[model samples]
Target: MSDLFPLTVRDAVASRQGKRLVGPVNLDLSGQGACVVLGPNGSGKTTLLRLLHGIARLNKGQITWSCPKAEAQRRQAFVFQHPVMLRRSVLDNLAYPLLLRGVPRKSAQTEAAKMAERIGVSQMLDRPARVLSGGERQKVSLGRALICKPDLLFLDEPSASLDGRATREIEDILQSAKSAGTALILATHDMGQARRLADRVVFLLGGQVHEEGTATDFFARPKTQEAAAFLKGDIVEC
Candidate 1:
């Protein structure tokens, strides 16, 4: 259906407990390469990702997809920072998304097995998903997320709390997904990872977008002082 391009957000805002969390921001997703959200700690990167992915309620403004709502929903997926694993076998975890999409059980499991192999966890297919190691769980999460071949994927700190090897492994999977035409909107604090993966960049500070542009230009020469400071390893505050 490939109709989720140019997803637009205007004057969007979200709040929690009477406090602004993110938004009063604007953005457009043209179904391009990976878009990376960058900021220091507590800078609303996660909130912005959630907002864009339809996880966080939009308390104000609007987020509009170019396609029909149902089609848009069907083409989208979200991967949380702390991956949520069902209390079932890894195979079952991988099959769950397909099952939700009404894929036949036998077909879903068959596809799940293939995905497990793709994510390098086929040997752990029978293991309890909840008991798997951190890296394994994240792999299963990626496998599930990719099983349906979502057109756009929202990822929140997919490499957080993992070792170098594990982080690299996750990055590889993400890269593979991107190659297969799944647009990525990712949130991260790792500058190196951002530089490696980002095609476009959105820098958030104080619950609003500080600066945004092509990753090349943003990294090479940020127009805003806050973005420059952020790139220099200095902290940014509202």
Candidate 2:
């Protein structure tokens, strides 16, 4: 695994039309485990992940990764909730990134197939990715993200719309990824999923971090009323 740690965020913010959508927050994800971002809709979880992955430009402050810019970009991967697929076969979709990275075509093909099999999408590799069901497309997107064996993987509600079996498949793949030393940063509204996969949790409310702690601690004893209410399924507002 690549060393892509010591990630530092200082006063990061995301804004749109002069309205702050997230942050002015500080965080240090300098570890080797899964960090889950928790929040309701519009609570900034998605914005935070996008900012960290360099998809969204920060409106304030800075994010620093220990690795070189090019290396870090190559070593990290992001999968959005509603993953978009290319108008091509699943195998081709998975292989495209590797090919861009200069991996030989034969090797990329083999790796893509292996990833598909691992994610239970092997049977659909030859099928057009755009035609796959939502769950299958998610699997292919995740598989494509992992095909390069990224050191850091960011997921935005990866299983939000999947059925039980599909969710479990994603969870199993995530666990395997964790075991292989990939650092996972996931954003989800699913408390159960966070409990299952999180080493630590960051609770965002009103575009800011309301609380952050170990999964056990945050779930057992949230620091803020917002967090407490959220845990109870009550809508919390800033």
Candidate 3:
């Protein structure tokens, strides 16, 4: 978020074993708030997020950010649909990252406890993270990711298979993150969730971006036939 505006991508592409999975994508993202990536299964939503986060290599294209590499790396965070937890307590899991950054033990514990409260996991702080339920683990993962106050956050199918209550909690957390000047890119097939969180929408189909526009514009009138069919709840083939 530190003047890292105008994130540029040119001819972005991703492939595996010579099979293109996502790409020929180009984007310019700036400012704060959430940018939602919407599409059905195998539409390259996950692949796109991974590629943007540097977790996956792109077969072609250039991505440039104005910020320093060290700054971006330290201020970026990613939370997956199914979060992996450590064997330690939930509080310990939250504190571990801070400890690695050289935060004092007492400060780390205090911040972890505070984050637990903020994310509605205060009661589970002492419990082993590995023993928590799926919803609880996801909450902890979100808290852990946000504990550092990241400038950019990425979420892929964050609410997949989660109950309504859990999903709402995640949405609320996203709202808070946006308010704190954290830029977010979330990928999901849930149109309702996309409507709630997106400032902009990126529609992917068959490893390509079918459409990109404001949430209001894209949802009201998708430019492509594929996007239109998708919004109407019809199945589409890439």
* Global fold similarity of model 2 (TM-score): 0.96
* lDDT, candidates in the order shown: 0.90, 0.89, 0.89
lDDT of 3: 0.89
Tens digits of per-residue lDDT for model 1 on 36-123? 9998888899999888877789999999999886788788899888998998999999999889879999999999999988999989
What lDDT does candidate 1 reach at residue 167?
92
Per-residue lDDT value at 175 in model 1: 93
Candidate 2 residue-wise lDDT, 114-146, digit = tens: 888898988888999999988899989988899
Models 1 onward score TM values of 0.97, 0.96, 0.97
Candidate 3 — which residues are off by over 4 angstroms? none
Alpha carbon lDDT of residue 113, candidate 2?
A: 92
